[model samples]
Target: MRALFRGLSPFNVTRRLYRWTMKAVRRAVEHFRRSLRLQLITTFVFCLLAALLAATLAHGMTETLYKRPYVDYTLSMQRMDWETRHLATIIRDQSETDISALQPMLDNFEQDVGLRMLLVNLDGKVLLKSAKATESQVDLYSVISRAMELRLDLNVFHPQEFVAFYPVELAGQKGYLIARGMPEANIRYESTGVNMISVPVFLVVLIYLFYRFTRRKTGYIEELADSLLVISQGKLDHRVEVRGEDELGSLARNINRMAQDLQENIERERQAEKTKNELITNVSHDLRTPLTSVLGYLRLLKDHPAGGLEQQEYTRIAYEKAEHLKRLVEDLFEYTTLSGQGVQLYRQTICMNELVEQLVEEYVPLAEEQQLSFCKALPDERLYVSVDPEKFVRVLENLFSNAIKYGKKPGSIGVTLAREADGIRLSVANRADEMAPEALNRLFERFYRVEQSRSRKTGGSGLGLAIVKSIVELHGGSIKADYRDGVLSFHIWLPVPGS
Candidate 1:
């Protein structure tokens, strides 16, 4: 206990506790202020005002309880004097046999009232006593302590307005005594400990309100911060919900507007890329066609019997190289035009079944001439769709040409046109070597060449598929290629009228 007391001394413990408390208060206030638009100064002032008012009321209540006559708060000396005289009346009564029974009566009164009754002679010797012992736990010491601390004469209490009177008839004395006041009322801290904290009641309320407001404000700010991060990551489509016409709401509106502008810029950039791809494709094709013709004429000259043998071989080689160059140029032009052109639909509602039958019939002879079989799984129903008729015909022709060129000798080619939920699906397939998956990914690129069917022997300008892609997209549709089980297939989906 001695060591504990030393450790908890005011000099050491009190200063440290105060410093730590101050630091905690500062940190808490700073953290809270970051979330607040209100001032701590005003709150502290209000708490001070409340503390003063509450403390005044508490003092009044304690003083009032102390002064109540029902509590008999007068000093014990007066109470003892009045009770001694009252007991003397019973003891010295003129009534018959009173003196003989007086001691027992006093004992009975002591039992009922819980006071140590005594009668003393003039010499101060105890003549009679009823209770066994005197009271030791008196309230005087506590009252004295409070009086000294508060600088008040609490022991010298004022007499109560009401009083009790006793009329006593002793053998030779007739006397009357009136008693005023009793004992002081106690206000123990154990019973009213909650009142100590009541002095700072406003401080507690202020802290609570501060915490609640800070939490709400901090939550809103954190949400705004997170939304900003999302916007920065190219999510222009995202928007924040406005809280009110406050600073936070204004900030959200600005962020949303910026996102809108960014989305528009991205769209423009995409369109520009599309236009650039088209120009390059057209330039390549325009440059390649004439080059092919020139190379063909050069080959004619080299094959002539008039030409010398060694020189002729060199000329033939040169012609072949020129032809390769011509093909490359043609691919570039075809890819360019396909990219640049927008959808210009000469839309006509055409029966796709008869169209497919007629096209297959015309192309069947070509397949047979190459010792290959031609088959078509066409829709039996006369399927109708709005289409640019001429462009559609060209699209079919390009697909057929590609299939015929790449199909294995004496192998089969299939063309199918089917109705789909949203549109039409046209598939053209030719049996060939397994196509590279990477090749499929870039099949629409200008001059994109794969090792298998992409060689010159297959006789493609490499832009036929690219052209098909353009035509299909111009009609507000899409095209894709898949190679599986030795079948090189192209699929296109065009929107129907409702879809």
Candidate 2:
């Protein structure tokens, strides 16, 4: 029975209904927020509710200040009329005509009740007065006649006073009972006028507050519009300020991010253009010098074939210049290919220790020819790295060649390979003339060379270190150069397999 009652319980039913109602309300609210018309309608309804609430509060205050006191005054007058009737009835029942007998009772009524009363005969002549009469004499008969004609039981006793006269029958005689000296006015005319003025003033204030509220809300939209206009005028550096956590603020943040990206892209494009122009100027000068030498030597050889020994010397000079030009072009082409995003790499896991050892051995003869000593520091543990073997070998060759060309006379060229915590560290250092700190920073830029230490006699196209950097980057490695203690060092860090 308990289970049956639980299933039929009103509480359970109410909970289910509440859940459904809340779900529907949430859906409606979401819809209202998404639709502009619905949102405006909701705002209007809210403002209307606010206005109505303000009006209700004002009405309650008005009733407390004016209406209630006036109602209580009216009730007090009715009570006074009843008391007057009761006193007159007492006088008729007692059949008292002597002034002395009723004088104490009338005095007690006047003192206790705080009202002045009078009795008059059918002829409208005053027969008794409990208090002094301050007003001038009036035609009481005409007043009574007019009140009776109008069928009013009470009539105004005097102008501009809170006094009334009630007609009564006492001991088979018609007479009038007058009441005077009532309570002072509690609800004044001035207070009613103030209330009337305050209502319209309150309404005006409510409208102004609503207008400011709506205007502040829509002000964000206007800011967005102005921001878009400024951005459209090519002010990529400009950003919109975010003012809230709502959708409008999110849009402003997105616009700011877009502007930042556009500014960065534009700056990058400008730098690229400058770099392109520099590259063209450098390549043109290099190529023209070598081609002119080759052409001039070939022309001399062609015109003086019979001038035997001199002709052979001119032919040899032309051949050397042609080879130098070929090497320059090849280096340029290779650098361009490696710099491209679409260059495919044939990656394989190679033992870096063995590769370094082999490269050192290959460069030992060149070191000896240059009168530079070879120093090697390699670990026995095999370090494996995944890289394009051909490109990786080229990077090592470039460093070794540069060391051979630029090392000081009789100075030692050192090659060190070791396994670091993160990856493999390869350092190639050569004792050379101290290079400027600024030169080390730009050592890997294409066609860049330190004029003090590097020359055409080194037989390089100045793209070797740049090519090495590109290859290292393609293999997800990094390369940097440093100069310290008269030794220029190039450090390469390559990630180990699976690291």
Candidate 3:
């Protein structure tokens, strides 16, 4: 019902929609950023479009600055041809009339249109000419004869300048009218060389743009390959630089992660090997000491045939040493089992107060024998916990034993069981030799002893606390040691039911 109300809420609906939309957008962006094929395709399309645009701009520039003037000149020459043809027709119509009357008109036309006009008779002599025609030379009879042979009334020519010839009749004979316009500009001719080079230049530009776009990707790939080679040569600390969120970058990240994991695993294996070696040395020393004593006493019993109190005393000492050896072996076995994977727990709910009291009472006699007294503070309420009874007993026994063995003479071992907000707190504190912080930290490590000789004297295999910690942790509890002043304390916190 609450979920329904939240779904129906306007603000919630809008917020959720907004979040979903943003998430989709972010996903799309991430995909674009990471997709290698998409990036290549996009770069190709962009380069193509850019190349086309560049070509278009070049063509437009070439047309305007190089080709435009030629086009305009061609059109001007055609208009000049038409004008010259019209003048020739007028001369043909008034051939017997005075041709000089047209001279003023031709001069006016030449000044206005910037052209040189000429009127020729059949003898190839210039009969009339414009002011600008002084610089113009013409073979009007030949031009007229060519036009007549070609049956052309209008003819345009280009040698050094624009020239147009039109046939006419002067004094009842064949003649011509000619018009010369401005010299043509050589812009198109000059740009022919530029046009030839432009294609190669454009191609080079396109290739450069392609290289600029793809160089980073290729360089990154090379760098990643080099880093991989270094890492493969056992340099697990080497890493590749991640450029984008693309496939290559993800591969680099994966490679880095693999290297780190491998490095850590190798270090862990080395530590485990070292620990195995130390365990072998410590176990050999510990077992040999008690075994030698047991053998020595048995040898004394065998060498002496005295079936008397002396023999019994040797038997008792040998038996005690054997017992100590047996206990050490059992502790070692239990620790190995607890330290391994998949340890099963026979969990049951039990009253923690009762459990603590029973263990303390059981250890009281041992404590008294060691000249230690018990100062236990257990809660009044029946605090409940789920734990394995056997393992819990071992945990308490180890702590109590350590307290009794290491406590100063005539000192008290304080055992406290209290309820905490998070769990149940049980502590076994004793007045003993002050321990350094380093020793305190290593108290629960396998085969670790604060003082090796002292531990041996007390018949401690150094596996008791390790086994205890392993059992407590297997039961989902934690244990720690603290030292303050002359007191060394072992604190165990177990989770209460439903904690």
Candidate 4:
């Protein structure tokens, strides 16, 4: 019930909605910022909106500054037309041919409303004029006649002024009364000038802003190109800067990773070259020693053929040298094959308990001959593992041989084989002087020896532990060494069948 309440809570719903909204907004913003098509569309939309706003404002200003005032003036003229019609009816009722008697009224009206008044007869003679119209020498009959024909009620344009005229009857005859005013300053002409100046200026500014925006956003591509050039020149340490969670940023991250991998690969190649050189030097020295000894013995046998005992001694020494040389060559060949990519394993299931016992028994005589005690602790339950029989035996033989050769005299050598939940653990331990941590760490490295002099005395080719490690790894097993309480131990773990 609590879970249900929590799920249905308004706060949870709002929070989830907020998160979804933010995620969508972020995606939209990223798309607009990263995609060229979207950017172009956005720019076009912004420009269009700006243009619409400018046009709307210009239209509003035109109405306010020009059209609205003109409309107000026309409305005022319409109100005055009723007043003028009444005045015309008064003149017709009074039978006045000249409106000079009402000149004061007309003058006051013209002054109040910003217009000039003129009265004309059928013969085209002006009978009355408002204040400040006496300077006009133009005839009004033709202008009034044209205005009346057009039936214009407001804003009648002439060459020098705007006019409104009303036809009326006076003394049973037709005549015209005119109201004239100077034209207002033309506002649309000034507005047109302003629009002409402002539109191009606004467009220029918008274009510049867009250029800067696009250039800043796309600058990452230039940086990427420069970084690629650096990498091409073998500077794998250089990296492009990542600025956003976008495709360009992802590309930069991938390029950085590639550069790091390239650097590591180059370092590995360098180390391999150095190791190869060391291996060649060591092999040459080891081979020369055995070959020189074999040659010396052969020469002694050739020079002293008559001395039977000396000849036998020479033959025996030469045979021992040849045997050591053969063992060295075989170890080198086996290590090379195992280290190479092409090594193949022929696997079989074997009882590890029996194998361990057989190996211990076979090495017991050699251990006893060296005055070293041998002990074995094996589980009664059979522990089976899949392995290459010949190679696996070689691994055990190398360990047993190492223990026999380097183990303390009169000390015990022990072997233990047991089953583990994950796999099987086999340990071979012998009483020996504790080795340095550095030596233990490199024990499985090719040509590595804890005691350089002892290596020569024991005829070790320095590839035994290396070969053992490679073979174990090939079988998907692991081997490690530990020393405690003056006992050197080699621990091996091999996976069980189907494990």
**Highest TM-score against the true fold, candidate:** 1
Model 4 C-alpha lDDT per residue in residues 430-471, reported as the tens digit of each score: 988878989899999998887778456754888999999999
Top-lDDT candidate index: 3
Counted clashes in each candidate structure? 15, 0, 0, 0
Residue-level lDDT for 447 in candidate 2: 84
The 0-to-1 C-alpha lDDT of every candidate, in the order given, reads 0.66, 0.75, 0.78, 0.76
Residue 149 of model 1 has an lDDT of 39
The TM-scores of all predictions, comma-separated, are 0.49, 0.48, 0.46, 0.46
Off by over 4 Å in 1: 1-327, 341-343, 436-442, 452-455, 458-461
lDDT of 3 by residue, 57-124 (tens): 77666653553333224445556567777777777888787767778878987987667888776566
The residue pairs that clash in candidate 2, if any, are none
Give the C-alpha miss distance for residue 115 in model 4, angstroms.
50
Q: Report the candidate with higher TM-score, 1 versus 3.
A: 1
Tell me the lDDT of model 3 at 350: 97
Which residue runs does candidate 2 get wrong by more than 4 Å? 1-307, 452-454
54-83: candidate 1 lDDT, tens digit per residue: 667665566434442433234453454456
lDDT of 2 by residue, 363-389 (tens): 888889889877899898888999999
